[model samples]
Target: MKKFLKVMLVCVMVLFAFTLVFGTSKKDEKEGIVIGFSNASVSNSWRVFMVANYEHEVTLHPEIAASYYTDADDKPEKQIADVDDLLVKGIDVLIISPAVQDAVNPAVEKAFDMGIPVIVFDRKVTTDKYTTFIETSNYEMGKAQGEWLAKELNGKGKIVAFSGVAGSGPAEDRWKGAQDAFSKYPGIEILGQQYTDWSPPKAKGVMEAFIQQFSQIDGIWADSGLMSWPALEALKEAGRPLVPSTGEQLNAYAKFVVKNNLRGFIYPFPAWMSRIAVQYAIKAAQGEKLPKYIEIPVDPIGPDEIADYVQMDKSDFWWVGDDQMPEEFLPSFD
Candidate 1:
C-alpha cells in the first residue's frame, strides 16, 4: 500500500509540472511586444476619439504584450520629454503625432536611431527619419471643400476663409490646397482669411466681426468644419441669410447643415488613422516590410451623404463618419 501511494503521488506531481509548463508557454506566446504611443494632445473630442481607437486596437491583439501612451497637452517641450520616456521603456515601436511640425523631429529621429520602428501619424516632423508616416491628404480635403463651395456659389462669390491652428501641417497644407482650387475659379473671391485656433468661440467672434464689416458675403470657407457651427451661430445672431460653406466632418456641423438646409461640404479626417498607425507599428516591429508613407484618402462628405454619417444622439463634439467602432466601444465624456 505504501509503494502504491508513493507512485500515485509522483504521477500527480508530473502532471502538475506539465500543466505549469504548458500554461507558461501559452502566457509567453501572448506577452512580448510592447508598443508606445506619444500623442500631441487629448484636449479636444477628435484627439480623445483617436486615443480611444488606439486603445481599442491594442485590446484586439493578444501579441501586444503592453501599451504605453503619453499626452503632450499640445506642448512641444512636453512631447519631446514624453517620447524620451517612451524610448526608455524599451518599447519595440514608437507611434507619434507631433505637437509641433518641426520641434518634435529630434525625439523621432532619436527613436529611429535606437533601432525602434517609428510610425508618425496625423501630424509630421520636419525630417523624414521615421520608418512610416500615416496621414490624410490635407491638400485634397481643402481642394474638395473649395470645389464644392465654388459649385454652390455658381463659380462666383465673396467668401471668408477660416483656418485651424496656425503653422500646423494640416492647416498649412489645407490652406494651400484651398487656395489652389479657388484660384481656378477667378470669379470666387476670398474676402478675408484668419486663423481660428480651431475654436468655435473664436470662429464666432471672427464671423461676427466679418458680419459687422461686410454686408453681402456669399460664402464661408473653413478648412476645419469645426468652425462651421460657430460661424452659423454668428450669422444667425446677425440675422444674415445662409450661404454656401466649407468645413470638416463633425456630426454637430452636419446636423446643423441638414436641419437648416444649408449648402455645405464636409471633409472628415478619420479617427482611425491612429489605429492604422498602430497596425503598421506592430507589423514593422515584427520585422515585416512597410510602406514609407501611407496616405489616408480625403473623401468629402456631400450633402446627399450627410445623413448617412451623422449620429444625432452622440455628443456635439463627435466627428462624422467615425463609425470604426460602436458607440459603447468608448465612453462619451459628456
Candidate 2:
C-alpha cells in the first residue's frame, strides 16, 4: 500500500510539471509577435498596390506568427476604432497610414503609451508618438516638379495646379512646396488650383473647367498621375495640344507620355513604402532600436528617361514605382 501511494504521488507531480511546461509553450505559440496594420483606404490604385505589397511582405518573415489588418475607408472615425480594436487584440506592434493628420492622434498616442510600438507611414498623424515615420518627402516631390516646370517655361507661364485630397498631409505639403517654388518666379501665374481627391473623374471635370476659364495654359502641374492622366485626357477631348506637365511614376502616365511624345517630369511616390514599413514593424517587434524618421529617396524621371519607365504591356492602373513586388503580386485593374 505504501509503495502504491508513493507511486501515485510521483505520477501527480510529473503530470503537474508537464502541464505547466506545455501550457506556457502553447500560450507563447498562440501569442507570438502579432502585428496589426491599419490602412487608410484602398480607394485608388496606389493604395491598392500598397496594401498588396504589405500583405506580400508579411509572408516573407516567418517569425511574424500572426497579423491583423484593417482598412478605414478614408474615414477618421473608423480608423480610430480600428486602431482601438487592434490594441484589444493584443498586438505587439501597430503600423498605420492615417486617414487625416489630426483626427488619429489620440489612438496613436494611446498605443505608444501602452508600450505597443507604433509605426506611421504614407500619411501622418500630428503627434510624434510613433516609433518611426517612413515616407518620401512630399514637399520635395512637389518642389522638384514645380522647379522643373518653372525652368521649362523660362520661369514664366500661365499654369494651373491639381492637388490631391484637401486637408491631407501629403496634399498640403506638396501644395505648399509647389507654391514656394512658383513664388520664386514673378512671371509665373497660377490660373487656379483645385483638389481632385485623387480621383481621375474629378480631375477631368476640374481640368475641363480650367480649359474654359483660361484661353492659354502653357504648363500643367499635378500632384500625382491619378489626377494628371485624367487632366491630360480632358485636354485631348477639348482638342488642345499636349503641354509640358509634371506627374508621378505611374505606368499609365508613362505610356501616355510615350504615346503622345509629351514633354513631362515623373517623380515616383513608391507604393513599396509599405513593404519597408512591414520590415520596420518586424524589427520593432524584436526590440531593435530604430531611427525616429526614415525618408525614402525620390528621383525624378525626365522626358529623356520617361520611356525607360514605361511598361506598355502592363495595365493602365499599374504603378511603375512598385517594382519591389513580384510581378504576380502587382495590382492590375484590367
Candidate 3:
C-alpha cells in the first residue's frame, strides 16, 4: 500500500515539474521582442532588393524572436493601417518607410506614444516622435547628378527630368536639389519634368511623349535607375543619339553606359537601408543609445567607375549592398 502511494506521489511531482518547465518557456517566448516593419512598397526592383536584404538580415539575429511586415503599396492610407495592425500584434519595435510625410505622421506618433521604439527609414514623417531615421541625402544625390550634367553639357542644354512617384519625399527632395543646381546656370533649360512612378513602362511612355514634343533634347536626369534604361530605349526608338544622363548603379544601366560610351553618372542609392533599419530597431529594443538621424553617403559612378560596380551576371536591377551582405547575397532574377 505504501509503495503504491509513493509511486502516485512521484508521478504527480514529475507532472508538476514538466508543467513548470513548459510554462516558463512559454512565458519567455511570449515576452520576446517582435520587430515590425511597415514598408512603403515592394512595387519596384529597388524595393524588392531592400525587402530581400531585410528578410536575410532578420535571420542573422537570434535575439529577434519573430518579425512582421506589411506592404503599403505606396499608399499612405494603407501604411497607416499597416502600422495599426502591427501594433495589434504587440510589437516591441516599429520600423517604417513612410509613403508620405504628412499622412504617416500621426501613425508614427501613435507608435511613439505607445512606448514602442520607432525607426523610420527611406522616407520620413513630419513629426520628430520616431526614435531613428535612416536615409540617403536625396538633395545631395540630385545635386551631384545635376552638377555633372551641367559640366558634361557645358552648363547649357535642354534636359528632361524624371522623378519617382509624385508627392513622395525622395522625389520632392531630388527635384528640389536638381533645381537648385540648374538654377545657377541660366543657359540650362528644363524641357519637361514628369513623374515616372519609378516604373520603366511609365517612363517610356513619358519619354515617348517628350520626344514627340521636342526635337532637341540635350540630356536626361532621373531620381533613380528605374527610368535610365527606358530613357535609352525611348531615345533609340525615336532615332535620337544617346545623351548625357544620370541614374543609380544598376547592372543594366552600368552596362548601357559602358557599351555606348555615354556621358552618364550613377549616383547610387544603396538598397541596404532596410537592413540598417532592422539593425537600429534591434539596438533600440536592447536599450542601446541610437542617433536620431543616420545619413548614408552617395557613391557616384562615372564612366571610368562603371566597371567596379557592374556585375553582368546579376540581374539588371541589382545594386551594391553594404558590407554585412555576402557577395552572393543578390537574389537571382534572371
Q: Pick the candidate with the highest TM-score.
A: 2
Per-candidate TM-scores read: 0.87, 0.90, 0.88
Candidate 2, 1-334: lDDT as tens digits: 2243234334433433443344345447774567888888776778777876776787677666666777787899999999999898778899999998889999999999999999999987789898999999988999999999999999988998999878778888888889999999999999999998888889899999999999999989999988888888889899987888998977788888899999889989989999999999989988999999999997789999998879998878788868576766554454
* Candidate numbers sorted by TM-score from highest down: 2, 3, 1
Candidate 2, residue 68: how far the Cα is off, in Å: 0.7
Residue pairs clashing, model 3 = none
lDDT of 2: 0.83
RMSD of each: 12.7, 13.3, 12.6
- Highest lDDT, which number? 2
lDDT of 1 at 147: 83
- Per-residue lDDT of 137 in model 1: 85
The C-alpha local distance difference test score for the whole of candidate 3 amounts to: 0.80
Superposed model 2: Cα runs more than 4 Å off: 1-31
The clash tally of candidate 1 reads 1
Expressed as tens digits, the lDDT of each residue in 65-157 for candidate 3 is: 667777787899999999999899777899898887778898999999999999998887889999998999888888888888888899999
Q: Rate the local accuracy (lDDT) of all candidates.
A: 0.79, 0.83, 0.80
